[model samples]
Target: MMRREFLRGTFGVAGASLLSEVATGLSGGGAVVAAPKSKITGGTIDLREFHRMRRFADLSMGRIAYVERGKGPVALFLHGFPLNGYQWRGALERLSPYRRCIAADFMGLGYSEVPENADISIPAQADMLAALLDHLKIDEVDLVANDSGGLTAQLFVARHGSRVRSLLLTNCDVDENSPPPAFLPVIQLGHQPGAADKFIAPQVADKNFARTDKGLGIAYTHPAQLTDEAIDCYFGPLVSSPARKEQFSRFLLALEPNLLVPIRSQLKEFRKPVHIVWATDDIFFGVEWAEWLDRTLPGSRGVRRVEGAKLFFPEEMPDVIAEEAKALWGVSRSPGGSL
Candidate 1:
């Protein structure tokens, strides 16, 4: 069944109203009233509670929106483009008990309030993350990322390797594979005025439309299950205002240049433990790239390929991420935790 239909059948009026309020509040930058304290059921996090979890850090770049849970050593989660910290909700739900999990929306995407002239390039994103860590007084973190976030994570580790205890990367740009050919059209369209709005606004309006191959559905394994609330949470902010659209466009345009090639030597020199969990079916970033990462990195723990999964599989299959992360940290489910 379509996720929207399921939501209607399951929640009826009040639940739908709550979801609407959460979406409206998050997208419109208004207040969400009477949000349920706990919105996690099974592994998914409710949009309302996800909004409530948001904490902003004011830096020179902008007000960075993030969410954190648990109490222990730090683990930072970086999401893919056109997505926010909300993508890691499932992983955070599962792994927060063992480590303090943080998911920060990048400068342009999600709820991060950046200036009109803010440099939302990948390098600037790396610098922003450093400033954010400093603001939080965190010396180091176990870094986890997917898609473009993987690219930023590599740059982050290259620039601040000492600050990262380990690394977990999913399907994303790597070395010469940076800004894969499939993404060229997006960069092209992003350079044009109002093009991003044409692409994203419709998806936000119709949950099912967002699941089409033309939309973000191509990135997910189960596109039909992509929820209405998730669609609004992910795309609403990008189209909320003219300034936001410009920043989102800048984010894509900035990625057109190859930023990863210059860091190849640095990546090779990064001696921290690195684990790669790649989705084989991802057209943009293939498993060959994962193999390339394994061969390139000196401290690589090797690559684990998930057959038939797409680019955003980490959101759908958080268990794989959790398992790889625990293995990388050498921790397991036990009463005594915090490694």
Candidate 2:
């Protein structure tokens, strides 16, 4: 089903009214009323609670949102743009039992705030992440990144190789010169004044699939399973902040030019063990990018394709990511080799 239809069915009028109130409050005219907290289900994880529950560290650009759970080797998760650390909700739950899991919402996304006139480029983001790690007193971590976060991960490893134990990338575009076609318009809009508001406002309500919501729905895995409350939890933040929208636009535009130079200079120098996990049917970025990344990085193992998954493979196949991460870290049940 389409995302709009699902929202209509699940939220009805009352939920819509709540969303309206949230939007109005963000505009500074209405008194903000905290919504009643939803009950947390043990079986199904909620990233909103994870974000809301944590205390954030003030960074160079903004307040960095992060959560640390469990113990052992640390695992740091970085998410893509338009989305936040919430993208790792599934992987965080599955992997939390094995190791310390750290997930952060990048500036201008989720609960994190973007300082005025701050640089939201990939390198800056990598620096912010490093700063966050320093603040948390973490010296090393196994990095898992998706989409644009993948680029940030690469920058981190390139700059500070000793800190990374291993690398896990899922459905991210790593090539500097080649970016997805769907991203071009957004990038262009970001460079132009007021263009982001004109372009992104209308489409924020709908599923962002090129063909059908089916492609987008696969990322969630359970289409009918998503409640209106969940949808609101995801979409409300973006609609609430106009500044966030503007910063996000700048972020999109800055990604390509800012990252291209660093990635080109440092990609070959990266010697950490790298694993690329890609979805077979992703419309935004294809498997070709993964192949190129694997070939370029000297320590890359290879690319692993997840069947019936899409761009958001971590969300779609969390178990697979957890299993791969375990194997990559050499923490398997078997004595010393492959399981």
Candidate 3:
């Protein structure tokens, strides 16, 4: 069944209205509504009471929307492009109680404020991440990153190595694989006038249109698994302003592998703990790269590969992420608690 149909069948009018309000609120002006229970692709995760959504101003960079939970040591999660902290809901639900879990929407994406000058490069995001940590008064954190977030994490750790206690990198751009083959053309299109809007806007505006070749359909292991809530959760932030479109386009345009050169040098001698959870079938970043990473970083404990998962495994396979998080951080579940 289509996700929209399932949503209508499951909650009828009230659910649909709540989703609309949340989406509207994310854009700019509307009443904020939190779901009692957020349904994943087909199931539900009880997140109503635990979730904390707020916006924090980062000096001159504008406000960044973030999701937070738990109360122990901080474990900050950085999401990739075209998505937000919403992607880490499952992990946040699982680990927040044991550790402070925080996930932020990158400056121009997700629910964050879209500044007139949207800085969306890897370095820019890394800078914004530092600002966020400072704003929250979090001096150090165990960092977890996936997809493009991994790249940003690399830059963040490289530039501000002291702030990171441990690092977890999932399937993402590494070395010379900044813009994967499938996304190269899309990134190229962003450089042109009005081209980014033509390609990016339609997918967000229409639900069914998002599940085709033009959108994120190809990135998922199975395109049919996408939910309307997920799409709107991601799309609402971008559709809210024209500046956000430019930000997305600029992020693609700024893809450069050379930027990671410093990270290689920094991570080589670094003694901090590092773990990897990779998707074996990811077309963008192959397992071979994971093998390369394991050997390069002195802190790398090991590499764990997940078969049959794709680029978006953090969301698609959140249980896997939680398991890996537990293993990486040596976290033990509390009595009767489960991920």
Candidate 4:
């Protein structure tokens, strides 16, 4: 079936937030591998020790690894590219005590197993997520997606919106603006033979790739704060082997043309609430895109910017993300977020 057909087939119109067309202008577009295993929150624990908490789920393609915590209605998190579910650690840690938080490693990215002949694209990721929710018998959830996962969130809602209780989107692809140009180099690396190796070597040899744009630099305004330990949590598993590199390359190459265009029309049919937490300084996706989202997604709560933060603002400002999530669920601070 075509993409729109799939979306319309899966979802029923739903009700839920806050944006009408913005009076402002806009632009738009929009990883993990890490080791030394620790929990995903705030980079405080040893990744090795933390990752011990991950569990796997059997899916059609393969097993998906995930970290589950807290209690209440489910709050599922979808991470961006080249990274695993660990990217959601900070927010998960904060949000879990109230609502259940489950962050999964996309098939093959972290502890998840890769299925043979996997499409490895945004739509596939959405299918995987839907399968996971169904496997677990979850009916609806508050969905929070970042980076490329944001695109997946849009597709999921378009096709299976009833599954989404609400949505929180961070800096990511919007409408026609996707795979932001700043990130084109990583995709280009996948096109050339041995080019991915050049990018991978520095990361493995000395973890020096963290200093490069494709590494930690492009995503953080304060890249210096991403200590070697923190960087290890983000890149180690991604470049764990040559096969993994090829897998990563295929994932990059899978960004099919017109992947997001269809969502433009479908989203108009969306009535659920949406909350946009963006990093204004992110060159890949600027405020214009956020405004476009505010205008396009009638459910939007309005866009909030994390001043001075870049792409990985979720990691850099986890508390803010958690708080925003709480507000989205109408949970207030004091003891913990409401369930």
Q: Which candidate is the best by lDDT?
A: 1
lDDT by residue (1-339, candidate 3, tens digit) is 222332232211222211221112112111212221222433234333313355466566877778787787899998876778877878887777668899988876777775667666779889888988898889998999988888888888888999998898888877767665545655655677654466656776776767643356645656566776677777766756667767766766777445776567887766789888776556567776777778888888777776555677777667677777887777666623443
TM-score of each: 0.87, 0.77, 0.82, 0.83
- Clashing pairs for model 1 are none
Q: For candidate 4, lDDT tens digit of each residue in 237-286?
A: 66776666677777777653547776788887777888888876665676
lDDT of 3 at 108: 67
Q: Candidate 4: minimum summed lDDT over ten consecutive residues — where?
A: 15-24
Clashes of 2: 0
- Cα lDDT, all candidates: 0.80, 0.64, 0.69, 0.70
Q: Can you write out model 1's per-residue Cα lDDT over 203-308, one digit (the tens) per residue?
A: 8777886876557886886777788888888999999999998888889898899988998999989888988887766767866788889898988878777665
> Predictions ranked by lDDT, top down?
1, 4, 3, 2
RMSD of each: 11.2, 11.8, 11.5, 10.9
TM-score, cand. 1 vs. native: 0.87
Residue 174 in model 2: shift from native, Å?
1.9
> Candidate 1: lDDT over CA atoms?
0.80
| Tens-digit per-residue lDDT, 91-180, candidate 2 | 777777777888898776667776757877777888888888888888999999987888778788777778998899887767653355
Q: Give the best candidate by TM-score.
A: 1
